[model samples]
Target: MKRCILEGTRIWQGDPEAKDTYVDFKGSFRTEGTGRVFLRISADSNYTVWVNGQVAGFSGCADYPDFRRFDRIELTKFCREENELRITVWHYGIQTQTYLSADGFLLFDIYEGTNLLLKSDRHILSRINPFYRNGYCKSISPQLGCSFFYDATKSETPYQESVEQGPGLAHWREQKPLRLKAPVKAKITPSDKGYFIDLGKETVGFFFLEADSPEEQLLTVFYSERLIGGKVNGRPGWLDFSLEYKAKKGENRYLNTFRRIAGRYLFIECPKGLNIRYAGVCPTDYPLVETHRKFADPLVQKIYDTSVYTLRCCLHEHYEDCPGREQALYAMDSRNQMLCGYFAFRGSAYQRSNLVLISKGLRPDGLLSICFPAGMDYPIPFFSLVYVMQVYEYLSYTKDQSLLPIVRGTLDTIMKTFRSRIEENGLIASFEYPFWNFYEWTDLSHNASQIGRTKEDKTPKQYDLSLNCMYIYVADMYDKMTGEHTETEGMKKAIKEHFFLADKGIYRIDTLHDRYSQLSNSLALLAGLGDRELAKNILTDPDMIPVSLSMTTFLYDGLLKTDSGYRDFILENIKTKYKKMLDAGTTTFWENEDSILDSKAVESLCHGWSALPAYYFHILEA
Candidate 1:
């Protein structure tokens, strides 16, 4: 009988400050007979698995230090009695939007027919990966962490020992392994500086390349969702979508499991001598199959399929706002995704898991982080209130009352924070310094988008219409969930007392400004501060400030709440709006309608929030 341990041993690179650290581990164990083999593994950041010399599986769920999740990988097909295992783990030691910095470690467990054969410890051979440069930490975006520089010319180092670090603060739990798909490749086309590889559509994936070079060929890969001036504009906006790799002489095979590129085009800048055999990206999707339902109208059905595809692209470990640039989870952005996901997909686990992940992002000030597990402290007050609504809707749809108790404290904290901020006018004032008071991309919330990253707040404090309306909405949800009394009536009264313009049949932006926006008006109607007549008026007002693609969900919801027959209006509106994207041959929807003609061309083409037609087409059949 073989003595075995079920849990894997945790190993670290021995230094926490070794940011952008990548380690390669390999070990071998002999089995007496052929049996089912499995590997249970977890890591601080990300991990990839290989059996013998063939690729097997890759991905560690995005987790907080308090709750580190592991993946269970089956390797029966790739293994033999005399077997070798290789696992490469890249730990981002610094905090970013989706990833939180934590103890950098890797734990491995191998099992054969329930008999544990191997586990990670100092006994397992490991060394710092020589191919991937360790310290050259260049960022693709502040939101999406770091870019990689791989040098194939660099020789592998001698196997060394990995220091044993005990299981960390996070409780260990097994998770469903990531779904790996076949790599999507493109024929290389000659361009200005190099060759452009277009995959025909946006794909959230890992870079894979198999090529041969006459001599040492240094290649710079510039990738993007769309082309500017017929060239791949890698750094379209605040993003630096580029990677550098040194190809050694002869054949070179690389499957970059580190940085996940979300784009249709990859432009490789290399000399003429390099011969490309295969070049593309392998998509890693959240393992959830879609239930297809085509509409009567072919255009509507086409839009529905495209919207569903957009939602699929954004869902990896969690619900990312977009797969292109900012692969982070924000409450406001995810609220749209969740509502649409309720109709598009069958399972509720992905939505529930995302709600839990966002719950772990609470700050000391009682607001959720701008994004989940984000290192920075730029909390959006409007977005935080949306969390309560999201939680209610999630629970309401699933009837999963169990989740409320888990997230009840978060709900309480968020409500209290906003309630306490109510000023003499009976409305919550705009959040002070450090807290971004952004409502939407439009000038509705004073166009806070102009203020990029700053610690100072130049905007004055006034009772903002959107914030107060959201507070009322959240307070109502809080009251219903907790069965506790809230000052929601007073808050609603104050909102009407200050911002409502009865004659104009709309709400003002704030006390400081006379502006009115579709977002603010929609929120007011949804919160029951207004009635069906108000909804009809808001829909008709040509002068009301229009909403962006992100906030259109609320607009549609408000309209439906007052009148179900308004579904026809929503169906036509959606078909009209999303048809433009269909006409442009978009595989996924755009970030906003303005992105279609905008010269900047830096907008994300596959935004999850913009995929609301998937939800509408399901409920309000066109």
Candidate 2:
């Protein structure tokens, strides 16, 4: 058996007057057998995992009282017995006041055939690959250590940098640029009452308590890299100070300026024997272990545990970025519990209203993060469906008939705004604004063309399969709920005759174009428009299968609806393509397979749609 343990490790030491206080430990591991692995990790705050050198999973939170995040990795193909794992961990904020006894260990069970051979300590032991601290730490899940670049420069370019307040800092400026000197000296002074740090920024990073208490400790940076300083105004993280600098910029001028201003930028600890420990240096590649621990029962438990998270995620209650009740619910949980309200607002009021109700049950500004794709600006046929679906979901999930007044009022606002924009053809026209106005059609990369507004307009009149089908589904669902079918039947008939090219065995945006999209196929079947048998057959077809299997939502749904053969096909495909997806190293599913886009480029990483698999698992079992 292999194992590594660290006990009574203090990551934070609170003193009334201290500059620094916090500690963190991290490690990495790889598996050596094609079996299952169970990981049990407990820490002060939370941890994240990267498989095959990409972020694969993460867990933990003080917000949700019952949130105990443990990971069980299935080392199949993408992750070989010799795979790589990376873990980064953040310690609890000093204000947490939880008894500190930090521990990190790994136990791996090696197997040969049905019999188990050995289980190594989470850390790898080898002659050439010595059991040093650095490399193994790189391969572990939930790593510790974040990057800090103030005046870090290479090749004469100053990185573009900004210092802004975190969750709080109403008084602080947004993306405030700060000039600094090289080797910035960060020193702290600790007193019995609290602590203080003179970092030489316009804002002094310090804390003071009125009397003796752990929460009174000053200079409490939960993670030093993220906070120059912050306040605890009622909520846990009220005030915030952070430095965000781009390393890719020319000359790194901003970093150089900050470095030049500060004399010494190295990690500093204050007097009174500060509770601080060097989490680890920045930009340093840590060591890693390849083998993993396995357990038959643990794997089952993991599935059940993940299902609970999926439910929480579907309600947009857990993850990185949950949406509001009034927004569209994407199929996944992008937000952690903080915004555990809703998903994407591509187009669906049922999804949005469910998400918004979930949010209202939690926070006041729950719906702010709910983004309506091409709302107000880019008008598209599918976008309005988002509004309709959210209303239905909100009504159903909450079962609150009293809110009918609010719901009706919001619907009126939507109808009044969009009704005027509908073209003579009864289809909502694409926004005719600058810079690719329509969200769905315009943003797609497959040689996108415009959808004209007027009947006489010249742009391709190709109607979208997914959009039209969703229109039918939402319109029908809405009419049943509200006693007004309106023009729903007309919409459904038009879609069936025009886009439903029967002879081709696949629906098309335009029968003449013969375009076949994975989205069109999935939505067509899901909306109950296409022939079930033909749709099932085409889904199993090798060429279409790859695209359909790219996202787990489709696969999970297909597997539940189809027989053993179809399920096996998707299972094998997922197993085969798992590594390629993780090797791409994305925290969330991407718009495409290639995920190495510029970080500065605006893209959705925690998009709700991609997380549908998490939700699909529950629906499958149900």
Candidate 3:
């Protein structure tokens, strides 16, 4: 019911380490309606909210980056008549003071129509207190000035993490070793002929030039409105931009398989001729980021990350392009490069090889494999092979020696982790658990087959053919690095015996009975897991084309290794699939060959795994 809602609170920063603390503020509001209520809250990071007796909402222990405002939540679900909103704040800290305000932490206004129905210090409550806060209280405000009571030094402090927000970027959560880059010196100056603005590439977010000078610079960024597009001299600004399409001076540019990556922004004053020319270039090969405000907004990234997690949770999809499909795919190489570096430094080799895209946390425990049916829940060593391959490929392309220490450390870590997982039968288990389809299969359109489950079968799940082959490839790479044949020969022999079928081109899975899957067939070639000749035949197989298309050009890669002629054919196919996806209005990669438009239907959006095509496209071009 398109009900208008503007909700948030303003509060003073309090020394969280004080007890019996109170903050009082006065805000006057008058409203009339049959069912009118204001959801008010002082703060709710791991706390609860109450407006009179009705419950508002409960929050988990969160690492909120700021102390200026309260959560702006929709309270339409909790609106009540005769609004006497009272908030009870609880603190688990032994030496912290919680702040309470009458205008709330911010002013929240609610209306049923033009009639201002309910106005309160806060808007929206958890309706129920979170059980996390050990203690509770009643009646905290309206004193306006002195609103706290607690031993400022001995009060328990609310727990917090350092992932806070910024102006044109997300919160700077020191990514282990690398904190967010320092703000580039952006200076705009006026020249004699025209205004020369030197942002010095502080172009982290959306920037538009309104006119030649600050007098005509109509720049105002509002958080509540997601509308980021603006006008330059009363004309469509960003939409009117046309680029020369190349990296600017003094910028590092990266070319991924499908996109280019560069860090520069240019805002040109429109010329007053027949057509005003505004030019800028985004080096990535994927879609240009639509909103710099969003990219720079930590809240947006948090929300986007939530969407990515939701998709990962629903289906075990781990490809970067699934959620922010194009965006993730474009950033895959850079992101993984960083991830590989981070894990390498952390001494977690188990994750070094897993070409994990976006998952839960940046730790070994959260890495997932690229192979489908592997899903986001499972992490296998094969994906590590892919990751290492890409890392080497990027090193070769960029010739950046800065990554050497990381690469070497990662190889060492992967070897150690894989050694522990390898069974006596020369096979490494996919995850901590044996293969028992962790979750039901979700299809391309985000629909479930709804297959009923049976008892967990433990018949020593036949050695997965694709996985074993990838092990051979990675083990071989490891041998190259260490100058010793460490487990490569054994893995290779097992792959050939168990995975290679005389009749079918490749073994889909390790079953005594031969069954071929497009995935198993393609990965066999991609991973260099099977004989070169057979891998080529499988790629051109008529039955495999749909599956191959579904797999995108990720498999086109193996064809380059096997048969050079497949290059043109593969590129053409990539174009065709790109067009098809565009036709389907698909912004990201699909789980199957359908349903790419339903945004709510979850699939891994930041899947660094599936974004291989973007990287592959770059590698092939190179």
Candidate 4:
């Protein structure tokens, strides 16, 4: 049955054109002899729920308002004969790459067992927060959402105090229960800057601080996936994630709970004369049971455990590319994450939800965006092909056919769009539309291209061997899964004729570039465009452009397909590369091998896509 919003609550919006807005709401109710008190809470964009000054819960999973999610909390423990409830809703009025922002609103209901108690209405005392200066600052990673500025000098509002109110007037329907798990306490270490708390692993959550100051002071908290030279590198850049709070005199207790910040390390900087009592992170993640699969080798065991932990950090309301930076769901990233989930976790619901979410990103032009449920559209053409392959993989692993019907239309549209672009030679022509043609993060000079600065770079507009091979691979899977014919043979033949250098036993990056890349040739082997001998030579060639950690998953897959004996070699390679991370004291896999990148500040230490080795362990053994 479709859930409806509580009756009489009007959808609230401070300013329709405001990009960011915060609305504080307060309501009070009296309950006598309550067996159990429950609160069904939800809001547009996101919300944090507090009952009588104690943290109750939070809700914000990207979704359309019609299908908005609500969390059910047992408020019995916090409830009293006379009770007060407070909620702060951070409504991003504008959309972004990961969230579909809409009008600001909050819908909630309080029930005593089965008996009705309270529902959100206009009578609920609500006001636009004067403290939060929306649009005052921008986020380091735009996709991660906006930053906030709150002025402590401003007069404090009684937003948390109980108030007599009437009823709200908006209609709503209930959906799935919120998937955000309860927060866990993190481990902390003292540092010169302040104190560093390691959540033991990367996770998406907020910092919890309890301190007291003789005088007013400002506290700054910096977050990062990895430290640089034994210190938190919070410099302003693409990955800069931090927060600020004002500590009042006497007692200061607060939780940076509005945004779900992701990091393994937190550096708290307290002003002089402030007495620090306690500081730690309340780590948040999806409540998925870890698979108890074990390996005899301790190194392999650590790798496997780390991979599982990486996935856990990336799993929340959806599969994020990285918790520290974007926190957006990319088809390519989520595809790898889903494969790892199939082996490392117990259920398929999260994978299915992610697949369906990406499928919803299909545009009118038959192309999917780089991320789903986004406000703005940034299409990575090849990632659309990856979406098809991801569906095939999900079906193969889970044997769940129900998703077919759900994604069938989007799949058909993608095939039709690609088919329309195929030239007479049966290969896709250079993309004419504005789209990202990213394959991997390999050196552009090595691939004979001048465009590699940004992921959205568009240069060397010509037929690409890697993209065509990816298409062939997905087409084959589509044919096998749907019993629908795809022109995989024609694509394979075109790829061979145009890109493969028979005499050199290497495939060109594209028709225009004479350069060879591991990405193109390795994919050729995986798509069966080249033989095992060719794959062997490509794997051994030092002259070939090296693959990035993100693309190494494909390289390994291709190598294993060419020859099963490569398993030992593959395991050794995994150990060699991942050992560097382990030696560096990382509890999770990294976005890239540290040596390949000059700086550790930019690298995500707990990247989900890098967790492919966990999946490989299961497959190689089988």
- The TM-scores of all predictions, comma-separated, are 0.95, 0.41, 0.42, 0.89
lDDT of 3 by residue, 1-622 (tens): 0122333322222443333233222222343444444332323223334444444433211122232222333345554444444343433232111112121122334455445544432323222122112222211111101111121112233422111111211111111110112233444433332323333221212222112221212111111000113211211221112111112122212111111111222333322211112222211111111111122434333333332322221111112232221122212233333332232122322122222222211225323332211112223344455554555544444455455554565566656666676777667544424212221122221112212222352334445555555556556656654465665566656566666776756664554446555555555665566557666667555644235333443356556667787767765665555455445433333443343333332232223333223433434451
Per-residue lDDT, model 2, residue 352, is 32
Model 2 CA deviation exceeding 4 Å by range: 1-381, 412-431, 434-461, 510-512, 540-608
Query: In terms of TM-score, how similar is model 4 to the real structure?
Result: 0.89
Write down the lDDT of every candidate, Cα atoms only.
0.81, 0.33, 0.34, 0.75
lDDT of 2 by residue, 446-532 (tens): 223442234344554344555555555566556656776446455556656666656667665433455565555655565665555
Pitting candidate 1 against candidate 4, the one with the higher lDDT is: 1
* Candidate 3 lDDT (Cα, 0 to 1): 0.34
TM-score rank, highest first?
A: 1, 4, 3, 2
Query: Candidate 4: where are CA atoms >4 Å away?
Result: 1-10, 29-40, 65-83, 110-115, 150-154, 158-203, 236-239, 445-460, 595-597
The candidate with the higher lDDT, 3 or 4, is 4
What residue runs in model 3 are displaced by over 4 Å at the alpha carbon?
1-381, 407-410, 423-425, 429-460, 480-484, 526-532, 540-554, 586-592, 597-600, 604-622
